[model samples]
Target: MYSSIYGGIIRHKFPLYKPNVNLEQLFGKHILFLFSFLTHENLNRAIRGGALESTRDVTIANREHLSDYLKVRDEYLYELDVHLDRFLSSASKAKISSPFSRSALRSILIQLTAASKCKKGTLRYWPSAGPGDFLLSSTGCPTSAFYAVVIDQELSQCKEGVKVITSSIPMKPPLFATAKNVNYLPNVLSVMEAEEKGASSSIWVDEEGYIAEGPNVNVAFITQDKELVMPPFDNILHGCTAKRLLELASKLVDQGLLKGVATKKLTVEEAKAAAEMMYVGSTLPLLPIIVWDDQPIGNGRVGELTMLLSDLLWDDMVAGPDTQRIPVPYAE
Candidate 1:
């Protein structure tokens, strides 16, 4: 049961979304059930504020006008499933070395598409939680529609003991970084930018110039003095993989392995001066970022602290007790 404040009143309820069965069998069931669960979850969360019930009603009414929201959500799910199956099947037969194979990327796309259908809003995922990796555009699909996809290792490369992970191809807006339903453009561009800049990868900046994230990963750094640094949550995407790393960091702090973990607003300049840098996501557990914008980060190489955290994160991801569970409502 998840609980939060709404209208200054405490609201508690079981999660609206939950997977009834393994997500691998998503296409075998009715997609509307999934959308309804997501819708209920978001609404309940919004209602926590207590004054937004009327607004919620209005939003639902407006959503109906945009088209059959449920149908659209189903379509998105179907498309995502199709893509995932294709990617995964192909990957199973291919010799892919990327952290996340094309199949993983497709799975994330499905999740994002489903979430967007419920909110009628748009969402973007960076390659490594830096800036722009591969973005999905669903803003034009419906007035009350949202689309998002995760950027992972399907677009990365390595060289000279440094692994450079780029986003997509052709770095530009509308076709690249601009928010939309399609994501391939930015994914391609971010990777190209990394290659051209001679950096391991490119970090994306939001409208305010704050380090938003990476193409398909989340950014984190360790200061020269060995302090863990990350951006505040307000402007960055909420990365599940990153969240896991933070949890691990908390445990490390408890065990006295790390000095501490800090989540604050950090500028690019501050990050560049940090002793070590890395990116985190579902696919790439932890990847060192030795350079940014052609400027050598820290020692112009992966930092020891960065590697330590990476190892810890990787160990947990591969064998941690935490099992992936879908929210209720989406659950069978």
Candidate 2:
């Protein structure tokens, strides 16, 4: 994990307690508070909400922040520029000022990825209002802060289909939904509702009865007429992967594999009648949805074109141009 407060990277294990041996040599006795908070008793208290008033706990406890996720492959960060752009845009919308410049942030992310030696995993980062007193507003924060961590994960193309149900949880307002902030209660509740109903995840429908998005991913469909259609992004999050899919899926149109590619409103009835359905997100890239609300989608099997689109996206992530993939500078 890299913290602007730490001013550098600190190696730690799953529980995020251990500081690197060099910290003692570098900071001497000054960094003792960091270790004190990492102790089992202190962590337990924080987890139990007994220490919610602590300044270091405010960023997460208060839930005033923004975050973004990126896929890392072969020590290469995929679509680094695109993800950074979205992150900065979200920060602007959330009124969170970044402590570092864009170039410096990019360099930090690359260097952190390299330091972790994680060939294939995820890079998750957050910009917060910074540690401050327990208050609803961020006025008490001295300055905004940034933190990022490299997670070791094994992600692959999701070929098999999964089931989903329409979410009953209230969807976030367009203002909040369009921004990738730390407010995800509705998303979590929707996913939980899906699990309770024996489905992988849930979809959110707008108040106007149009498909908004999935719990945390964007939804797309292959229409009966073979058109690749997704809900317009005006009211939902403008997903980077979904946008890329739209761009890459155009190849299918050129090759006569799909009729056309477009983004427009999709009602539940129209979406359910589609020949194929899928969820698009940074991690999933493309996940086929074969069933919704216990009813079969199309032939109740993964669509051939769905796999084709997934392969296109997977290939792009694995071997896309330099513009989309940034090579990480791992230590030799």
lDDT of each: 0.44, 0.83
Please provide, for model 2 over 1-332, each residue's C-alpha lDDT reduced to its tens digit, 9 standing for 90 to 100.
67776566765433333446444454444332331232223332211101111245346658888889899988799988988999999999998899999999999999888877777888888888887776878888888888787766789999999999999899999999999987999999999999999999999999999999997799999999999999999989999999999999989999999999999998899999999999999999899999999999999999999999999998998898898899998889
TM-score of each: 0.46, 0.89
Worst 10 residues of 1 by lDDT: 65-74
Evaluate model 2: give its TM-score.
0.89
lDDT of 1 at 332: 23
lDDT for position 168 in model 1? 36
How much does each candidate deviate from the true structure in C-alpha RMSD? Answer: 17.2, 5.6
Name the candidate that leads on TM-score: 2
lDDT of 1 by residue, 234-259 (tens): 54444555766777787667776668
Best by lDDT: 2
Q: How far off is model 1, as Cα RMSD? A: 17.2
Tell me which residue pairs clash in candidate 2.
none
